[model samples]
Target: MVKRVGIRDVAELAGVSISTVSNALNRPGRVSDELVERVRAASDRLGYVPLQAAQQLRVGRSGLLGMTVINIANPFFADMVAGAEDAATAAGLRILVGNASDDIAKELDHLELFERVQVEGALVSPFGPVDAWQERLRKRGVPVVLVDAVDDAGVMPSVSLDDVAGGRLAAEHLIRTGRKRLAFVGAREEVRQVRERLEGARAAVAAHPGVALEPIWTSTATTQRGLAFGDELADRRPEDRPDGIVTSNDHLAMGLLHGLIARGIRVPEDIAVVGYDDIEFAAIAEVPLTSVRQPAREMGRAAAEILIARINGTETPDLTNVVYQPELVIRASTSTAR
Candidate 1:
């Protein structure tokens, strides 16, 4: 095997001292432009890749940011990751992504791992209570920014969509469309997002005395679980079924739509459906889905900015919390017209 080239090789090739080569690679601002260019050219010519860990150890802080999300498989979270990468790159920082998969223990594990790795900061879209973990990370000198979830206690900075308003919008749309028998699908009590959305739907239903709301809980907020719930609903007698349904996310909505179609139930005319997150699949399903749009990518970018500010000691505590509004996107699933 070829011998691995080191920084010493670059220094020798560039005719500079080892310290000058180090400065050029680790902290370019400290080195003169001429020396920096020469070091870079020598490094390129020799194909030398500096050890990031050693450089970070010398600098006392890594330029790496940690990001923990509930689920990366979801298109919504995937978009969030993309936005975060874009923003972190702009800030001259790199991001390490971890998926907690909606498990609180897994979420805590990811946080502990990031802390041990000595990341400068973290952006977390939590699965459960975050203040305790936030405090722990802060005690270790790692700043944290919450993503797509709020700190109701006002202790942690967060960037999230107003899920409650999104829920209300979904339910109110069904009500306006003349569907009175309403049902909410997915287990909202477990996740803050779904819970807040359920609260919003409750508020809307409370406003209309005639609209009775029924809630069905699912084991997970995945498409498979949605399909199961939809199958169960399909088994019910026609008169006993809900006239309108709102799901926790678009995955569930699409699965439920497929389940309904398999059972020969016509969409909109039979049962109107509304889903959250407005994922790409929502628009292309057999029946276009009506959904509540959360600005996931913008939320991720905003969270990264906030976390970077805190890491740089430039963030104002009072302005740490950022909440974006949700919008309703109507489609054939909820409307008869194309």
Candidate 2:
């Protein structure tokens, strides 16, 4: 029978004590960087796989982390997950993800599930106020970090994009291109991101006197909703349609573009469109979409880092709120016709 390579072998190969090897693998941040690298290299070369059950027993905590998002189907959230996974793996931990699919009940259910499993920590991209959940987890001695949302009370750490700035960038670009009649398509005001974006767009329009922003509220910020809005707009008289449009996300904008083009409406020449998030599909659309880019992946990584620090009882000062700026990526969808 072949014997498994153990931590003792790794310690011997790395010229480190067993305690140093364990700390390097299990509590990387607590150990020196050079020693951690040496231990990792030795472990990799020896194919050493730590006994997870024994480690959990010894440490009194699982090696697993939990992440819940509003919708994993959305490319933005997908990117965030990738980033979080990368960070977690680097710290010698694994993540389990739950997709709420924008359901509050499901969101809570997932939180309960994570709690039942006793995750070391959790990162949540909550659909609504998470104070209750955060409190519940705190009582259970689990750390939680908010992803893509901010808690004004500052009770929990959070990482998010400057959505208002993204909205302003989208609106300002349209206005600069002489698009006077602009329309904003997004979900209800109850959604913080949508509300913030609309607020920013409104501010941008206010700065440009002649630019009027028409608010088109939807039940959901999805491709289907965007398509429905597009169809509705197509039925309107040409004179009544806005010259420029900004949707809350790339999927919605792509759907809108498809709906408009199918009805023989010329993009840019007639109506320019910009979307938020700058998702992957934005570049491959019939007419590539112009969009405001949010650093979704980086936000996820940052949120996970904060949660992990809290989980490890490591002091992280003044990192309660981390907000990233947005950038505008111009494409054919919003390029003005000569």
Q: Estimate each model's TM-score.
A: 0.88, 0.82
Every candidate's lDDT: 0.89, 0.89
Candidate 1 lDDT by residue in tens digits, 1-338: 99999988999999999999988987899989999999999999999998886678677978899999989989999999888998899998899899988788988998999988899899998888876597788789888888998887876799989998999999999999998899998764778898888889989999998999998888788888777777898899999999999999998899899889888889989999999999888889899999999888888998998888887889986659988999999999999985
What's the CA RMSD of model 2 in angstroms?
7.6
Q: Which ten residues in a row have the lowest lDDT in candidate 2?
A: 53-62
The TM-score of predicted model 1 comes to 0.88
Tens digit of lDDT per residue, candidate 2, span 81-187? Answer: 99999889999989989998878889999999999878998999988678658888989988888898888888888899898998999999999999999999987
- lDDT of residue 135 for candidate 2: 82
Candidate 1's displacement at residue 303, Å, is 1.1
Provide the clashing-pair count of each candidate structure.
0, 0
